[model samples]
Target chain A: MLKGETETELEYANMHYFFNDNTIITAGKFLLPFGQFGANLHPSWINKAVSNPGIYGGHGGNGSLGGVTSIMNDTGINVANTWVLGDAGRIFTDFYAVSGPRQEEGDHGGGVEIESKKGDNNDSMAFGGRIAYAFLPEWEIGMSYYSGAYSDDGDLNYSAYNIDFNWVGSYSSVRGEIFGSTAETEGEEEGEEEGHGEEWVKDFDKSGWYIQGTWQARQLGKSWLNPVEFVVRYSDIESDFDGSIEHDFEEDGGKTGSRIYYGVNYWLEPSAVLKLGAESTSIDNEEASHTSVPDDRIFLQLAFGF
Target chain B: MKSIKFVFTIIVLTTSAFSIKAQHVNDPSLVAKGAKVYSENCARCHNARPAEEYSKKEWSVVIPHMRAKAHMTGKEALAVEAFLASTLTADVRHAEEYTKPNAPKKSGAELVAQFGCQGCHQIKGEGGKLGPNLDGVVANKGEAFLLKKLIDPKFNNAASAMPKYPMNKDDVKAIIGFLKE
Candidate 1:
């Protein structure tokens, strides 16, 4: 799931049914079961950085470091289940089918948006699933894959995969995810003016990853300092599509560069947190058009869950 | 703006409280289990949401959404529901000062139950198996170790899923005393 795409209005509404302890079926609009950040850690109380990985932007954004990936919520039906493997291990799975990507139109035209929020432009539906394994009770690793038609003509297609892992120790935690994707698109030289203009077909590829670490300030001694946490994350995304319509791909977080984020968070209580963070981003593609260059930033925020 | 927000919070909490009392449950063990699950699972993503933030109906919608997204077991979802319900039925206001300074003295057993230690630590052959058995842990680990662990569960292991409780000397001593018995 992506952050910038979230609307202040109803984010999503879905109903789920449990067939058993290990199986559940959900219908209607819901969050995309993509990577750890979109599916899990996007919530303010949980995410360590004030800003998400630039590569995870969905749409409506042209962050200098943005790259087209995917959205956070869409109209879909998903089934999830868990299997306890003996006493020490477990397997978890989530599968879904939904309105896939749509060809971008209007201001930034020629590319794909990666989510059919207005509903699927084509009759074809998208499909995806994630499988994960848990061991040592506190450690987990997962793999996810998604594929579907993204064009109104249903001839153009997009596919992506993500690998993620998480581990929790008494005083620290580590988690991260890697996402890679490719898409086929056609734009007339003039992007397609009937039979009058030559056709250009591009096989665009993009990929990115982020790793985060957090350490609890337990050894710091003061009981009042016990709730403090130090966190750091690194992220990068790259793309091969150098189309003239750079904004179209950048809307989906397709800009190529790397970012480093470091922060500290203090828990006012179990349900409230105060955060101080700083981020530095480096851009690689000088040809990409952006209103402003990707810049380093510092921020402070208070997030209360109640 | 602050006044409006506070009023909104109050109205939501008050309405949810009414619904919770109608179906109030007093099962400490279930609440304990819910407490443990809520922290261990939910904390990984963000701060724990206060139970009164949602009505039972809202939680009905939220829990299932999370259950599917997080791949949580049905049992855990139910445990969290029970925990939230128990909290909503509580008379205490969320904005009220927490853990009052002049709180009445509680028995070590009460402290143990309040902290939900048995939810993870095996206690007299009962409770969970995630943490080490606490049946005779006082004698085995020594009082000093237990005291440190209580204040900072990560004192011994950085990755311990065990939560910390910053208790004053009296409460820590009482917890250790109860473990010895």
Candidate 2:
């Protein structure tokens, strides 16, 4: 869906499936899907031979700024101010709030994310508010804060903030942004999985951030026929569990070692583009990473505008 | 005289050697030749493409259409097709015509707009319409009639109110590619 600053709104959607070999099957509300499908004969008027992914980058995709506003979960239809100055820079002020899943602290020394009665009364009805400004084209900076309300009426609030900077060069471009999150949660007694008659007063906090850069179109064999772009970023987070919660949970301080991302974007066409990337995150104190997960992934994307 | 002959021979050999050493595959002259052919045989009906809008497929389709409609035979059709394809496929941003240090710059969209073409045509679903709807017209009309119209709009339509723009060989060929989309 598209709603121009001026002009009536339009609605649209795209559904597509991909096979491991990279062959794609697509069907949508409008227009022929990019490649072939069962019982779908291409039109003679349409030159399928000239069909190249590079032609219409993200032509028929759903989401990412072009869709019917009505289809959006309008529970939080907030407003934000946007300003762009020529080719040199841009600035924007955003205000937004939405409801859904939220982070809840679990029992100490327990399976991560599983809630036991003794842990903490952190179940929540959540709400968030943010006011931020960005100066762009090359350089940018920003900040935000959020909070959630627990069922017990006790407060489990957390605040998050960030700063960023970037540069655009002829052959390639680079950018770096840092973020920090701080949380103060009220804790319960030592071994209680369920609520106990006496509630203990305790405070816990968590904070972390990262910086990353990307170099694109560097001199390489890929640059001759196709422009290849590369990006890398590393991030880390640490938390301190305090008071009675530490004794029962057996976790007073926890840290996420570091996460690294390596990504590449290919310019398949003037308007169409594709990105492939992967990430690996190591744990500082655990025998295994979360899910013992492999931080390797590859994806291809295409975008086009009409 | 003998020494002079030796030096001349050496100069010839040296020139030949240097030329061979330069070995810059001189980006296929066939396209250049095709450009000339287009200007001479097809520009009257189809204009060349601007830097951004042309493509190889467009040129290929154009070749056959010109052969069928304008009667361009073997060599002429091939050459014009080559030229049309070159501009269509070359990165318009890096093309010399676009990158001159002091060259007046206009966004490709802006150039398309300035030609007053948007008044009658649209690319990829945008533009006005005093002319035949051109979205993929290149795929249909081929190059012959398009180039011909550039030189003389009335060649195909005695009553066409469109004025024939002043265009040389390269410019006409270039426009053909631009309209390909």
Candidate 3:
């Protein structure tokens, strides 16, 4: 809705058959099961902060992802199961093969990351998976990775690695995500010339990370203030390219540097939230290739999920 | 590096799978375990809904969807399924039977096992960290206070997440007795 190209996304519609009480084999389009964010935390109702850290790669968002972008879900078959440990601690695992990402004309894959694209560009299939260990009822640590060919001829390869974690405590909650990717750029014949620096031919070297902390006022002994959450987050994406250009954002100058956000959210219901926040996004000038400073802005948002 | 990681993932999953075993569907302890799983996993995604709102049919659909969405283990899903199923009626809730006592006075160990107390509190290094370790709980908190706390989790802190089980005085006494030992 924010991008105005409101195309409905049908990311996955498939079948999951349980082999036993602990194992499952699923076919057709399915969740990539990468980091904690996309699989477990992306739903707006659950997210504690207003801005997404650039770890989970995608075309465009408040802050364009750096180093690596995740195509959330795609056509594939997956094997997944959980192993309960001691009494409550358990390790969860997921693995799958998908049609893989395709290299687009421009840098950004755009809002079309999911629904608009149809068929794989190359014959090569992408493989990836995640493994996570959760314990203490409120804390989890995990790692995820993916690799595949995205070029038309299936020569150029795209691969990425991610580590993420989250812990919810009685008085505070903290979470973070970090991911990086390296993709071989498919060269354009038009700009091909000897000894000339062609950006397209340069590998997309991008990486980003962010950490957020949120606390409740329950300790104050005020019931009314307990529902208010104060959140602060710092995130950035730096690479060989710029986000506005690479992600196909319609903005004037496509620069992605670093961002910090301070927000206060009040809960009306568990799913409904009223958010008031301000953010300062600074583009690091040292990274000359993909550099720009977007203006800081304040926002008031009323968001809820059914 | 990628090959090593791929191999590592396989090893973890393969080894974990060997430990999977079929559960006896009628086990009453599942309800207690399910109660813990639901509290731990559900509040992360959305607000907690009372079991009163969902019928057995709605819960059947909800549990599987939640399992896939949150990547819950089959055991976790089954335990929660059993937990919610037991809550359908008061008689069913209280009647969810543990093993019948062979003798008149049930052993403290039996009550702990029946209630799945260690599912949250670490007992002899074999439980979750949801609750404080029971190793020194008896000494720190008196036996009388512990009994009252079990009867009323929010007796002191109104915001405690501890669930109130429909246990009688003898059941509570057994748990306290086991801790004192």
Model 2 lDDT on a 0 to 1 scale: 0.38
Candidate 3, residue B64: lDDT: 77
Task: Give the 10-residue window scoring lowest on summed lDDT in candidate 1 chain A.
Answer: A57-66
Lowest-sum lDDT 10-residue window in model 3 chain A: A108-117
**Cα lDDT, model 3, residue B137:** 73
What CAPRI class is candidate 2?
incorrect
* Per-candidate iRMSD: 10.2, 28.9, 8.5
- Of the candidates shown, which would achieve the greatest lDDT relative to the real structure? 1
Candidate 2 lDDT over B71-162, as tens digits, reads 34344456555444444424344657556766654443444433445433446675432245667767776788777777665554332334
Put down candidate 2 lDDT per residue, A198-217, tens digits, no spaces.
65544354444545454544
Error of 3 at A233 (Å): 1.8
lDDT of 1: 0.69
Predicted structure with the largest DockQ when compared to the true one: 3
Question: Of the candidates shown, which would achieve the greatest TM-score relative to the real structure?
Answer: 1
Which digits, one per residue and each the tens of the lDDT, describe model 1 over residues A1-306? 755545654557665556677887666677777777777777677677677866674233323576546656767677788887765477888898877888877887757675535666878778898898876336889999889888878998889999989887546789998888888766656535455677666677888888899887855545566778999989888877566533446444335788888999887665567899998877776555344465777879887653
- Report how closely model 3 matches the true complex, as a DockQ value: 0.19
Runs in model 1 deviating more than 4 A are A1-9, A58-63, A187-200, A242-254, A290-294, B1-39, B48-65, B80-115, B120-174
Candidate 2 chain A minimal-lDDT segment of 10 residues: A63-72
Off by over 4 Å in 3: A1-5, A56-61, A64-67, A106-117, A188-202, A241-254, A285-293, B1-28, B43-48, B88-181
Candidate 3 residue-wise lDDT, B10-56, digit = tens:
65455546644434354668877876777677755454454545666
Backbone steric clashes in candidate 2, count: 48
